[model samples]
Target: VISSFKIADIGTVDLDTIGTVEAGGMTVEVIDPVADYAELMESLFDFDALRALFKSGFRMRFDAMHAVTGPYAKEILENRLGAPNGTARNFIPLPDFGGHHPDPNLVHAKHLYDEMMGPDAPDFGAASDGDGDRNLIIGKGIFVTPSDSVAMLAANAHLAPGYKAGLKGIARSMPTSGAADRVAEKLGIGIYETPTGWKFFGNLLDADMATICGEESAGTGSNHVREKDGLWAVLLWLNILAARGESAKQIVTEHWAAYGRNYYSRHDYEEVETD
Candidate 1:
C-alpha cells in the first residue's frame, strides 16, 4: 500500500507531557518509483499496439500542470512509449504548481483545452491533477466529461491487453451519470452504485465484484490498483484508440449512436449561509 506524510501538518507538542527516548539515527530507503510505475503501466497494454499508434504519426500532448505526476508522465508517455520529447508539457513538479491550481478541469487546465481545440491540435490531450489520482481527457475538438469517460472506458475495455478477458463488473459513485449502466446491462455484468468516495468501491474491487470503478470527479481506475490512477486511465484510452483505429470524436459519436446518449449536469453552492 502507498502512503504519504506531510511534515507541514505536524503540530507543536509539549515535551513535558511525554517521555522522550534516545535512539539511534533512522535509515531511509529510496526506490526507483518512476521506473516501477512505468513498468506497471506498460504491463497493462500491448507494447506493439501502442507503438503502432505512435508510428502512424499519432501526436499526443500531456499537460502535467506542474504536479506530482509530471515525472511519471514524462517517463511513461515520452521515454517509454516513444512519444515526442515535448509530448508532455509542464513535465516538472513545482512546489507551488507554477502559481496555478493543479486541478484537471476546463477551468484549471484551460491552456491545454485551448491547444487541443486549436488548429494544430494534437491527436490526443490529457491532464492530471495534483497527487496524480484524477485525470481530464480531451480529444482534438472534444472534451470528454468524467461520466462519459468512465462509460466509454467500460464499453471498450476489452481492447486493452489487461482487460482482454473482459471486466467482471463496473462501479460508479452515486453522483456519476448512468451511462455505464447501459454498458453493464449489455455486457451482462454487475453494476454497483455507491456513495461518493473512493473507499466505497474498495470492497467491490477486493472481492472481484468490480473490475472498473470511477467517480464523477475526474477519477477512474480498475482492479489494477486500489486507488484511482490518472495515468492508467490515459493509457487505457490510448489502448482503446490504438486498437479501434478511430479518432476520439468518431469513437464518442459511435458510442452515443450505439448506447444512446445520457444527459447529466451537476450544481454546487459554495459558502452558503445556514438558512
Candidate 2:
C-alpha cells in the first residue's frame, strides 16, 4: 500500500487507524479534505489520552475565527491535541475572515467571548464556523447553549472513544431545545425531530435510526461523517473532559443537576427592506 504509506520513521504512531500517515520518508500527505479531516482526527480521537489528560493542569482554547478551521485548528489542536503554543486562536486562514465575522456567535466570537470570560481563562473554550460546520462552546465562565450543546454532547457520549459503543438513537432539529429530548429520555433511545437542513438528518443517519444529531444552529453530529462535525464537536468535548476528571464548569453543573433545564429563544430579521 505504497510501501505501507512509506515513512522512514520518526516517533511513528497510529493508534487506531483512519487512513494516510507516513513520516519523514514521505506519504503522510492527503493534502486536502482538511488534511483528510485531520486524518479522521487521528483515527477518531484519543490524542494519546488527550495528551495524557493534558499533561499537568490543563488549559485549552480554540478560536479559529480567521475562518476555515484555521488550518484545522492548528493541525488538530496544537499539533495533535496537546493544545498549547498560543492555543490556536485566530490561527489564520483568512479569506475575508480577516475581516472577522466567522460567526461562532456570542456576538461574532467577541474575541472568543472576551477570552472566555477572562481571569486568565482557558480550562476550555471553543469556536468554529465559516465552514468548519459551526460550534461554540466555552467553559471557564461557561456559555454552552446550542441547545445545551446537544445535551452536553449526548450526555458525555460515554466519555468518547468514538462514542464508546453507545448512542444508537437521538436526533434533533425542530428548534433543538428540549436538551436532546432529555438525552433521549435518559438513553432509552430513539428520539428524532428533524426539519432544519442536515438533509433532515439523512434518514436518521441511514436507518441506524440515529447516532446523535443536532442543531440550534451551533450544530452537533454523528453517524461519524454525514456532516455537522465542527471538529467533531470539539473532540466530543475533549472526550468528555478526559473521561470525566470534570470541569466544563463541572460538566454543566452536573448536567443541570441531572436533567432539569431546557430554555429556548430566538428571533432575527437582519436587514429587511421591503417597503
Candidate 3:
C-alpha cells in the first residue's frame, strides 16, 4: 500500500487512513482496522516458535524498500517476533517509497543484493513488495530464484506447526517452473496448475483441493488466507531453517542437488502491430 504520492506534494493524511499505529509510550487508536489485522496475525502465526528462532546468533534482515510495509515489518519482525531492533531496514512509512520501485527483485533491490554478496552479510536476507504480498529471499552468497523458492518452501512447510499436518495438495501457475511438481509427486499429493492470476486458484482453495498456491511472479500463500503473503513466506523460511538448523545456502544447494535445478527467466519484448 505504499502510495506513489509524496507527502510534500499532498498534505499529510489523517491517522484514520493508516488503520492503527503504535508510537512511543502512548498508543494511538485510529480507525482500528489495522489493530484487528495485528490481532489476526497473532492468532494465525506461531509467535512462540518465531520468538525462539530469533534468539541468539540467528541474524537476518528484512528490507522494506521504503514502503508502507516498513512499519508493519518492524513491528512484527522486531518487536513481536524478537528479531532485534535493526532486523528491518528502510522502515519508515513513506508514500513514494523514496523513489524506489518496491518490487523485491534483484534489479530494484540491488543494494540489498550487494549487501548479501558482501562479507558482512547476515545469515539470511529478505524483501517484501509495497503491497506486502510478494517476497524475495536470499541467504549469504545465494540468491534463491522465485521458482526454486516456492518449491523449497513447499518441501519444508511441514516443519512449521501451522503446516505440520501437511498440505493436502499444492497449486502453481502454468508458466511457473516444474520444481514444485517434483515435490508433489514425491509426496503423493495432488498438484493443480492454473493460468495466471491468483483468482484462478480461488476455487481450488475454497474446495480444499489445494492447501497452498504460488506463482513465478513471487507470489505464495496457503488456505490460511487467500492472498500471497510476504511475511508469511519469510516466517515459513525462518521456521524451516530453525527446524533444520542449516543455513539457507546449505538447504537450497541440497534441494537443487536432490531434485535438480530448474532455471528459467522472464523477458519483455516490444513489438510492432501485426497486419
TM-scores for candidates 1 onward, in order: 0.87, 0.29, 0.83
Q: By TM-score, how accurate is candidate 3?
A: 0.83
lDDT of 2 by residue, 61-134 (tens): 78878877788888877777666788888878877988867878787787777887888987888888888887
Q: Comparing candidate 1 with candidate 2, which one achieves the higher TM-score?
A: 1
Per-residue lDDT value at 234 in model 2: 85
Clashes of 1: 0
Best by lDDT: 1
Enumerate residue pairs that collide in model 3.
Answer: none
Residue 156, model 3: Cα distance from true site in angstroms:
0.8
Give candidate 3's error at residue 115 in angstroms. 0.6
lDDT of each: 0.89, 0.80, 0.83
Model 2, residue 190: what's the lDDT? 81
TM for candidate 1 is 0.87
lDDT of 1: 0.89
Clashes of each: 0, 0, 0
Q: Candidate 2's error at 100, in angstroms?
A: 4.3
lDDT measured at residue 78 in model 1 versus the true structure, 0 to 100: 75
Per-residue lDDT tens digits for candidate 1, residues 1-275, read 65975444334434443344333342233457788888888788876888778888999999899998999988877777788899898979999999988989888888899999999999999999989999999999998989999999999999988898999999999999999999999999999999988998999999999999998898999999878999899999999999999989898999999999888765645469979
Number of the top-ranking candidate, with TM-score as the measure: 1
- Residue pairs with backbone atoms closer than 3 Å in model 1 (clashes): none
